[model samples]
Structures are given as C-alpha cells and as structure tokens.
Target: MCSPEMSRSSDVDVRRTETRHEATHVKARRPGKGGACGHMALCHWALVAAMLCGPARTQRPPGIPGRTAENDVPLQTAAWLAEGRITAIHLPKERPRRLYFTLPKKTSAFSVTVVPCDVPVEWSLMVRTAEDEPPKQQRTYKKSMPEVWWGNSRKNIKVYSNVGNAVDTYRGPAYAPASIYVVKLQSREHSTKVSVYLQEGAGLPKVFPELPPDPQVRVVGVGMSSVTLRWPSSPSVPKVHQSNTSLQYCVLVNLKHNYRGLCAALEALRRDKKIEEVKRQGATLWPTPKAWKQQLGPHRKDVVFPAPVPDGPPELPCVCQGVENTCTVSELQPDTLYYLDVFLLDSSSGSSAAYTGTSARTHQEARPTGTALRDSKPRWVALAPHGGRLLSFRPRGWPPRALLTMQVCSPHQVRVTASGQTQVLAAEIVAEEPVQIWLQGSPSYLIYLENESPATVAEEAIVKIQASSAYHRQAPVLPPLRTVKSYSKLKTCNSVTVGWHGTEERNLYCVYHQQLDSQGGPTGLEQCLGPESRSDTERAVCKYFQDLNPQEAVSTATIGGLEPGTAYLFDVYMVRRFGIAIKYHSKIVRTKKDC
Candidate 1:
C-alpha cells in the first residue's frame, strides 16, 4: 500500500545506512586503519552518522573530532558573537552548533534583525564566556514579530538581518570583545529585520528672560486710616518724563468705600462758607481787593465778606487773645447738636478744603445773665476770739467790709469766749450813727458799724470780735493727674534730645523727661532728667528740648543726629514749688531732617 514517493524515501535512507556499515567493516578488517577499539567503535560512529543523515535536522554527538555542536548556528541564534567574520561547527549529540567571531575595539549600542526558515518557533537568547558560569541575559520581546522584523538600532552595529529563508536570523546590541558584552534577540515569528546605528547627542534647552520691575511712588502725610499719596513722573512715559502728574488721591479705608468723595464733599461744604468782599478802588466803584472777592451765584453784586445770611449771621473771626469780640449763631439753641469744620483756602483751586481733620463742639457752659439777690436771715453768730485764729468772720453789712459798726438791743455786760479766753463788753444801740472800734487780741484788727433805723434804744449786747474765717482761703485744689508730655530727638549715635513744655514753668521750673515708644503711648520705661538728676555745668532747668534720657536712642543725642524724619514719644512732668508735682502730659513729635 506504500506510495512511490514513500518507497523512494525508504530506499535512499536504507542505502545510506548500508554504505555507513560497509565502510565501518572495511576499516575494522584493515590492521592500522581502525580506531583503538577497532571496527566496533567505527560501527557505533557509523550508526550515529546514519541516524543524523536520515531525513532529520542533524545535531552534534559527544567526543567528535573536527566538528562541534557549540559553535555552528545562524547569527539570529548567536547574537552575542562579535562583529567580524565567524566560524561555526556542528556535533551530532551533545550540542547542535558552535560559533566563533572576532570583535572590534570600539562599539556603540546595537540591535538585531531576524528572518525565520521552515516552521515558526519560539526561542530564547543568552550569552556567556566559553569557560564557565551562567550566561548574562539581554532584552526579550514577548510578542511574535513578522518574518522580516526590525530591532532597536545602535551606534556601532551598522545593520544585521536574516540572510535566507533556509536559516533563522538573530539580532541585538553592538558587541565589543574589549568589554566582552553580549546582546540577544529572539522571536516566535518566521522572519525579522533589524538595523543598528548611532544618532546625534541631545543638547541643552533655552531659558525665558525675566520680566520688568514694579513701579514705585512716594507716600506722605500718613494719618490714622489714610495716607497722602504723591508720585513722580513715570519714567516710561514720553516727553512728560520729568513732569509731575496731577493726580487725585483716594483713601482706601478697609479696602472698601471711597473716602475721597466724603473728603471732597466736606471740602465743598467749606467752600460754600467762604466769604468774599468787594471794595471801592480809588474814586471808582471797582473792587479794590480784586483777588479777595469771589463770584456770586448769579445776578448779584459781588458778595461781601461778613455778609449776613438766613443762617442768622455773617462769618465772624473768633478772635483769640482778644476781648469784646463776639461770635454768634442765630439758629443755635440752648443745647443743640452741631460740629465745627476748619478749612484751608487754596488760591489755585479756588477750593476751600477742610483741614485734614479739625472739628469739635462749641463750649457747653452757660453764659451770665445778671439778676437781683434775695434776702435771708443771718444765722447764729459765734463770740470766739478766732484769736491768733484764722477761722472766724464778722460781716457788718450787706456788702461786708472792714470798717463798719452795728447796734443791737441786748444786755450791757455780754461775755465772749474763744481760745480758752473770756471777755465782757458793754453793748449799746446807736440811732443812725457810726462808731469805729479796734478789736483787741493776739491778732488785732478794727471794724466800724452804724444802725440805719431811727429812734433806737441803748441796750446791753455782746460785741463779739473774731478774725475773718479762712473759708475761701483753703488748701489750693490740685488739677487732675495727667501723663507727662515729653518729646525726644535723636542727637547722636549714643544719645537722645529731650524736650517738654508745661504751664507751671514759672513756679516749678523743673521738667522730668522719659523715653516712650513710638506711639507716644506708655512703654513703662522711664528715666529722670532735671536739675537734681543732672551733673555740674548743665543748667538747673534745661530748655524744653535739650536734655536726654540716659538709656535713650543715643548716648548724648542732639536733634541733628536723629533719623532724618522719624516720630518719637516721650513723657514729661512739672514739679511744683510748693504743691504736689504733676505729670502734665505725654506727647509725640516727628523729628525734622534739618532739626
């Protein structure tokens, strides 16, 4: 039943076997031709050779001569083999192939290409030294590639690929014998192609330039919640580079609402209050003070200053340091709610802007309205000497005075006692007549009195004599206690200049100065500075701004050495000549640059 093709394949296999047997037999019969074990070893070799040649892929056997299984294989299977020419051999049993190749001195990263022959099969690749040890592994691709596959290229290896459909190809990194490195590539595909080369190096990147700086402006006249703003010309602006820009300043209060409008409205209110006058020039009816008069609302002659208005009166200068000058407001009642606003007139803007801040209420004290006094009965009188005593008074009449006499109906012998002494004097009633008598005592004095009533009778009365009572002449009342008002200036690197002003400078000329924090608020830090505290040569009482705090901003400061312009706080006091000393007030001052 065997076909012709199957029969031919068997015949060829049989003849090849018979030829191997006859050759072995001939070698065994010959004396010197056989191997050490004679024809028996030769027959074993012949049978192995026969089997390898019988329609199967041949693999190497052990102990072979002139052929080895370790060195014979396609480039795809032995990718680690170096770059130059290669020699290969095959053995029947132990190993299928052996490979050898020369390597170049230098190389770069490389890759491999592969083309499969016959059946597609999965394979792994590895490399190592011929002598010993496990092989080093390279890259491994998990998925299958096409018959003609490409690999990662490297600098040194130009190109490598499968040579023919009959043999499998391998590819990998560049190899160098100097380093003895190995590369490997394997795939399940039938074929693949890979090229290796070196490209240019990566360079550094560029950077972005920086932006311009922020503009700056000057700040001045800072107050509780706002600051006066002023700025120099913008350098970036054309032609107007050095010219000052006219700008309206705004106050940001708590980052909300525009306070500038409130300020402006207040200013407008002041402007409406400004009074202007027109006077005759020479013999003409022209305005004399041309610059003084402001235009009126309409068809009205130029309004005159001190002009009366519906608000009851004209503007009157509240003259300070002068008397008889009256300031009046018609609508003002006994106790009305009102506020005063101060203003500064700007000639250029013709605007009367309220002074940054100056408003206060009018005085609340009642004015005098002269009236008559009512009569009252005199109280009981004391007959004490008030002697050498300064605690009694004897009023003679309505407007009590020194020399006055009075008559009363009483006992002729009346007794008076004071300071442990008693005296009896005759009392009499005088009719419309005056008499003067000098009181006799340690502190002697005189008095005269007369009765205005007619037809009075003579009677005994106690003529009590005593000195004027010391009622109004009491211990001087002290003013409320206040913090000392002192100011300091930096004089030198080691000292500070102190200054103070007070009302009692005449009687109690001494001033106590102490350093305080910048806010003019107390620092609880103080030092004395007055005649008693100063050494010789310094005046007993220094000027308001000359002394220094020992532990001041400087050692011995003068005004000039302080920060060109800076604020400082100080405490000052006044020592009275006789009464208890007082700390007058505390103050703050900004040191001027030139001071």
Candidate 2:
C-alpha cells in the first residue's frame, strides 16, 4: 500500500486529487480466475467522484449568520452597499468574484475579514478602486487571507492573501463623504464557502441635537471702580437636553487701557490675513513697546505723580449662577475704559459660550487739578474743659502765600490760634456772634470753641473755611519750592526701595507711588502706605508724616506687595509742621521679572 504524501503546490486543486484513493485503497483477492480487478477499481472511482462532485453544502461558522452571493458586480454599484453586514462568497475555479462596497460619509477607518468554512481553500484577494468599467489589478494575494485597504480616494486600494479566520483593519486617510471601495476574491478550487465582514469606523454619532444660542447681555450699572452686568436666561433648543438648570455665567473684564492698542493691532492684522493665520503667530501678533529704558529715555526728567494701586487679585473673572443672571465686578480702575465679555457655561459638558456685552468706561474721581483750592470738611477734635470741641483745618493743596478766610459760629465764646514755623501767629478770643480771621503761611490752624455760656448751651459749633482767592478773586500765591534735593529708586521683583534727600528741615516726609503703563502714564494709584480710613487721601498723607521723625533729612522707604515685571512712579514730598507740602520729587522704576 502507498502512503499519502504532502503536496507543496500553491494551487487549491492540489488538496483534492484521485491519487489519495489509489494510495489508501486496499486490494481484494480475486477468485481463482485471476481476472484483473478493474471492475472493483471502476466502482471505487465512481463513488469517489460522486462524493467530490455532488451538490455542495457548507455550514455557517459560529458568530456569523446569513449567506452572500458569489456573483460579480460593478465596482461603482457595490460602493453603495450597507456596511457592517456579513456577506458570503463562493470561490470559483475561474476568474475572481468582485464585491463592490461603499464607505459612509466621514468614514475614518474600515475593516474586512474572511472566514473559511468546510475546506481551507487557496484564495487571492485584491482591493481596487471603484470604476465605471472593470478595475485594473492593483494589489493581489494568494491563498486564504484577510486584508483591509486604506486610501484618500477609491483610485488604488490595498490587498491581502491567504486569509483564514483572521481580520485585517486599515485606517484610511481623511476622505470625503461616500467614497467607493471594492474587494476581489479568487481561488483555484470550486465550492469554497467564505464569510466576509465589512465594518466602517466606530464611535460615529447616530443622532445629534441642536444647542441653544448665546444669551444677550446688558450692562446694568457702571461705578467709579466697579461694573454690574446682567443677562437674560437662555432657552434650550429642540431635541436637546435642558442646560439652563446647570448653566453658569462668568464676567471677563479686560483693562481696556492695557489691551485696547493690542486689540486694535489684532483687528488690523485680521483685516490683512485670516484670523486663524494671525492666531498661529501667537503672542507675536500683539504689539510690544520697547524696553522701559528706551521708551522713557526722553521723558525720564519729567515729574510723575503717584497713581492708585489695584485693590484685589487682578484678572479674576466674576462668576455667577444661571439663575441669578447678574454679577458685579469690582476692583477696577477709575476713569478707564473696560471691555466686558460674558460667557455662559454648561456644568455637565464643561463648555462655555460668550455673550454679547458693550464696553463701559468708569467715571473719574473728584480730585484737585492744578493750583486749585478745594473746600473740604473740617477735622473735629475733642478738647478738655466742659467737653468742648475744636475744629482743625489743614489747608491742603493750597499755595504757601494764599490766605484762608475762617468763620466760626458757636453759642459760646470761641478762641482761634494760628501758628507757623514753630511760632504762634495769633491767639485770641472773640465774643461776637460769628468769628472771622485771615491767615497765610500757616500749614494748619486750630479753633478752640469753649462752652463758657450757660450750661443750657450745646457743646457743638459750626466752622466754615474758604481760600482768600475764592472771596477776593485775587491771583493766589505760587506754590513754595520743593524741599527734595535728590531721589533714587532700587527695585526688586516684588518690592521697591525709595531713597531721597531733603534740603530743609520739615515736619515729615511722605512717599507715594502708583503703577505705570508701558508709556509711563499712571494706570492706577497703588496704596503702599496702609489701609484707607474715613478720609482715604488725607489719612494716607497723615499716616506717612506721623510715622517718620520730624527732623530726618535722608529718608528711605520700601514699598512691597508690588507686581513683578511692572513699572511704577514714586513721589516723595517734604511736608511742613502744619501739613503743607513744601517740596516734592518723583522717580520712575521697573521691578524685576523674576525673583
């Protein structure tokens, strides 16, 4: 008997041959006639032929159902076939069967698998572009193989060979919607049953709902250093989940003085190029001024005034819940234009959309311009004897030679005293119904209102003071020359050391500073002195003078809590014993960028 031998032929026909019967069949002993066993051989050959050529049936593999035809279709026609469906194909002994399929819109990737049932037949697969006519051969594979193809267009595709119970996946290039694809299967054997699965990209959204539009915003009020914003509630769109319940809003206030120029430059760039292209350039798009030394070289000798510092954390947006729909943003610069952007936030998705709001400018505070004497309330003091009260008047922002007209109305007798340069000018009591006095060169004066009348008389009195120029309409005296000799600044990352020299002996020296913009103009006043009192400006000046020695000449004050990489203008003034500013000096310095 002959033994079965393995065949290495690539053709599928090699596995099915009549030589196996000749090798495994046993010979029967004939009767004594010794005739040839050709008849028995003929019977056995007929049975083997019947078993191989009879009606062929194949069972479906596990996890896959349905049957697919073995017919060839036009490549363009198959491009529209539904995806994710298993199609069965019968391998023929002749030409390959071409199955055309189409990828859905926005299909990023695709996969194809071929599972062979019954016999493992040698098959070839080729992926081709969809065409009106028959597609030309691009890639070919032999034997049972699974493969996936990827391309931007349906022009040329990938191919695989010898696929069995294996899946091939490919991530196609980004293609337009509804591109065509085709798969060709060919084998050297007939009646080979194979299942093919085509799955498009996953994670594609089946249904999408519309989102609500942005809410309309309005500016309710704008104060000197704060702004109040209000917005209407947003309604959810149809077919979308209601987001109003979980919605939140935030107010983004931009210091317009600092960003307006940059925003204008960006707008010009947008006019020249696309906004996306301009954004790609990043920070380069914003116009940055020259270095501080270069920009302020010409104006270095000019005097700079002390500016007000910002109060709280800068750049912190004001946030409010959706239900309130209103928010107040504070700690803003006065007399400054500010741009406001309101955004609606979705808590569930963590998404935000901007609202339309108009820009606003804060009102400037009431301040003295130049050489103007403004009237202010008197400082009340409790004096000894009969619980009497004294009214203290400090002629702030008044010229040294300008006289002040003082009027006092008290039920009891009133005594007025004026002093200057460590000497009393006058001290006298008036018995008239209203007392009046004219005084000059007195930094400050005190009025002693004594309750010397009957006990029924009240202890309170009324005092009114006005500048002599206001009543006489005469030109006021020019301010006295400043006592500051020289000034210098030493700046660190977050602190500044200011040292100055005074020429004359005075009451005290006070230092004030404010933040400056790129152009050396004051952005706001920075309070390095201390917390403000009832009379903020007066208290600041008083605290500085009172804290220092009265006769100190060389003074150095360090101001901390300053922002890094910022420029500031420091002013030093020598105040007289009566609160008169005799001399003043200013210097500009920039802090270090890093510690």
Candidate 3:
C-alpha cells in the first residue's frame, strides 16, 4: 500500500513532465466524402489547444507585432470544465492536463471516469478536490466488462493504473465547502485519447437512523468444551411490517468489556473509519458536525480495541433449526471464564446489534467417571439357543460414523459394519461363537446376530448395547454420491462469471469467494476462504446460493471486486440437511491484466 504522501508527490511530478511533451495535433487534410477537418475544425482544436497547452494560429491580428503561433504560448494552463458534459481529451506522451470544475452546491459529491480508446494505456485519470492535481498509487479493482482500477489517498481519488490498469472511473466526495475540484489526466510513455464522464451527487456515509432493538439471548446448556445458546431468530417486529431480510450472526467471547459496551465501541470504530475515509478522499463535501464526530467514537485513548479471537477453535456459528435460534460453541477450554456476545448482523454493510449475553462457565477438566443412573437404558433381549435376531444401530447425529459398543450380557454371535466399512469378526454365520460387535452409520445401521449352535450353547443368548450420539437418534440418511462441478461462463480483467453443474437434484448449493495469495495459494486455514476458513478476508458473504431442485442445473454469478492479475478460488458447497455445508467442488480462476 502506497502512503498518501508518496501518492501526492507522484501527482505533483506530472506538472514538470507535461511541459517537456507539449505539442499540438492537427487533422490531416484528406479530399474525400466527409473529408478531413476544415479551417473551422482547426480553429476549434486551436481553441482547445489555447485553453490547455500550445498556441493557436492567429493571422497576426492586423499588425499586432510578433503575436503569431510561432512564438506565442497558450493563454491558459488550466481550463474551466463544468459537470454534465462528456469531454474527450488527448494527452501527449509524458504530458498531463488539468481541468477545474465548480460544484453547484457546497455539499456536492463528484464522479469522474475515463474511457480509453485502446489497450495497454499508460495515462491516469486523477481527481483532486480542494487541490490541484491528478493521482495514482495503491489500486483497488472493481469492474464491469471493462475492468477499472481506482486509487484513494488523502489528496485525491484517482482512477488510474501505473503500468496497464484500465482505471477510468471515480465517484466520491469532494472537499467540503470548497467550490473547485481539479481533474487531471497524466500520460507516461504513450499518448492516448480518453473520454471523461463526470457527475456530482451526495456520497457521504453519515446517516444516523434509528437502530433496531437487540435480541435476547440465553445460555441453553454447557458442556466441558462447548456451550449451547438459544435466542429469538429475529427481533419481535409486527407481522405486517416484518421484513424478509436475512440476518447473519456472530458470537464473540472472552472480551475485556461487556458485550453491550464492546458492541457500541465497534460501532464507534466503524464510524471513525468512515470519517477518516471521507476526510482523506474528500469524500464528503460538508464537514462532519463537531458534536457528531465527538459522539461517533469511544473517544478514549486508553480503551484499546482487542484483536480478533485467537487461533484456538473453529469460528462460532449461528445455525437456525426452524424458528429456534440455537447454536453450539464447541472446542473451548474447560474450566475457563468466558464473556459471551452474539451480534445480529443484517446486511453486508457492517451494521449490527449486540444482544445482551449471559456469561457461562464450562465444567472442570476432571470429573467423576459415573454416578447417577442413566437417562436412557440399553434394551436387553433374551434369545433362544438357536434363534437369530436383527437389531438396529442408532446413529450419533454429529459424527461421520455411527458407533455402537456392544457388551455381551451372555455369549452371543454378532456381525455389524465398522466405520461404514465391512469388518466381520466372530460372526455366527461366518464364524461360530457369539462375541461383541461395533456398528456405525447415520440414521442407523443394522447389527446381525444369531444364537450359538445347540451343540455349543446351553442357556438363552443375551446382549446389551451402549452408545453416545447427538441430541437426537435419527434414521439413517444417505448423502448423494454425485459431485458438484463448476466452470467459467465468462472471464474478464477484474471479474469472473461462473456456473456450476452436476449437483444433487435435491441439494441447496452456495458459492463462496476466496482470493488466493499471489504466490501460489493460501498456505493454511488462516488464509483459506472455504467454510473452514478463519481468515478475516473470508467475508460472511454468500454471492450465489440456489436450490438446485427447482432451478436449472446452471446458476451463474459474476463475481466482481477482484484484483487484476490475481487468482481466486471459488468453492461450491452443498448444504446438506442440518445446515452442514459440505464442499463439493472448487475452481481456481485467475483474472487478466486490466490493460
């Protein structure tokens, strides 16, 4: 990232460079239909040349001594440009041009863009409010079909690239109460024609509307390393006025400040960033009120904003069952104090509300092995000496394998699948004696058993089974064996339109954006953007999600806001039942150079 001071210096250097390349361009005369420009066209270009650089040819204006184009220089260095007009300006190599605009209102915002005629452009479009220059430096990319790179600094907001960035656009706040803003185009090594489109409007982010009320959250239960929480899925709003806006949830724990205070502080921090951006880029045409600025932040130097929760466990997830707002935070330390917070986020914009949270402590590391009677008892069955019985194995909902431990109340023969794999040991049908069996699968698995032969057995065969599972023991569920596939629909400099194929007909699939590191790819979980990514760069954004059941097989989304010449990973995840996002497929796409 280039600093503001360095970017401003680069803007100032355009002045000295422009003078060395000062020259006039005239249309060559071609005798044909709609022929070359006439004398009127020469005068018009001469006028524009007079306003920008170079001298206009005058017929010595009736004895005006030495007032000829031969020695006369341009009368003006900079010209007055107004809004609501499109101007096509030509910049000579190493030369730059500056145009000034007068804002109609004191609080008007400004927008400017340059449309280059050809590729591999070296000219930059810079807009400086309350200053005199164009700009360059750090680049942020966003695009349509033609990719555009933009730069923001303390002095100006510029739409340009150093080498080959097709940055011809900028819309941002102008300096407040200042009537004049400067637009300049600087060219390096190449002369080019760029059409400048300009506009003005209100572009500041400082609206203080009423925020919705917070949610009420409570601790549902606590385990040694996990805590279950429940709260209202949404705020209690009137049915007639209730919105269908989807909300995102984030839980913060182990903070120095209380949940409410920390939430307020975060809000203040966001406003502070907005204020800084506005002031730095001249993004506000009006100054923030003194009281508003003072009230916008915590305003305490001693109060430190803590870093994000460290790399210990998985991110806290808010999974909704139905209308029940319940979630479990697992993989926590036992016997540790925790300060919990649940933030209800409404939109991609960082606006959120932190509900009041209840602090809960986890159980100690060491506890008695067993004491109280079991809430559920395994059913014991008596079998005839030669009888065969088929028993079902219950699944542990959260685990990949449904595991059951069997204790032989009496000698018995048993056979069951292990870890979804077939491992037969001491099977009465295959072997002879009845031993123990372990079965695993989801929903449930079937355990095959038979009483010992009459020659080896005497009394009836008995067995007891035990297992641990999620809160509910459900019937087995068979996941689709098919695969999800992704392909590029269109590729551009700063965006990639992608489509997916071959997903389960009944599955819901979501696409996620992952910006890869420049070298090869992300090295660890800290840098990945998949569902398991803990990186801050992995935003809580779902670009495209669809129920493939009712929709067409191909769903596409043009993912923008990507950097030029960078690679990105797009992941397609199938949302299995119970809100589990199982990654089905991933595609690595690299964008072209914006030039």
TM-score of every prediction relative to native: 0.14, 0.25, 0.23
Which candidate achieves the best TM-score against the true structure? 2
Against the correct fold, how does model 2 do in TM-score?
Answer: 0.25
Tens-digit lDDT string for candidate 1 (1-595): 2222322233245456457656767767776645466667766776786675543222211111111122122233232343321211112222112222323334443322221222222322233222222122312323112100111111233233232222233434443322222232333332322212111112211010111142222343333322333333222223432223211121111111121222223223233343331122100011111211332234124333323322221123321101111222222222222232222222223222121322222233332221111111111122222111122234334323222122122223222222111232223433211122223322222222222222342422323222332222223222233333323433434334554333322434343233334454532112212234443433323333222322221111133333545655433444433322333344455555553
Better of 1 and 2 by lDDT: 2
lDDT of 3 at 240: 49
Off by over 4 Å in 2: 1-216, 237-246, 257-318, 331-336, 363-595
All candidates in order of TM-score, best leading: 2, 3, 1
Candidate that beats the other on TM-score, 1 or 2, i.e. the better one: 2
Candidate 3 residue lDDT tens string, 359-426:
78788665222212122234445567776565544444446333243434444453333322223322
RMSD of candidates 1 onward, in order: 42.5, 28.0, 32.4
Best of the candidates, lDDT: 3
Candidate 3 displacement at residue 246 in angstroms: 11
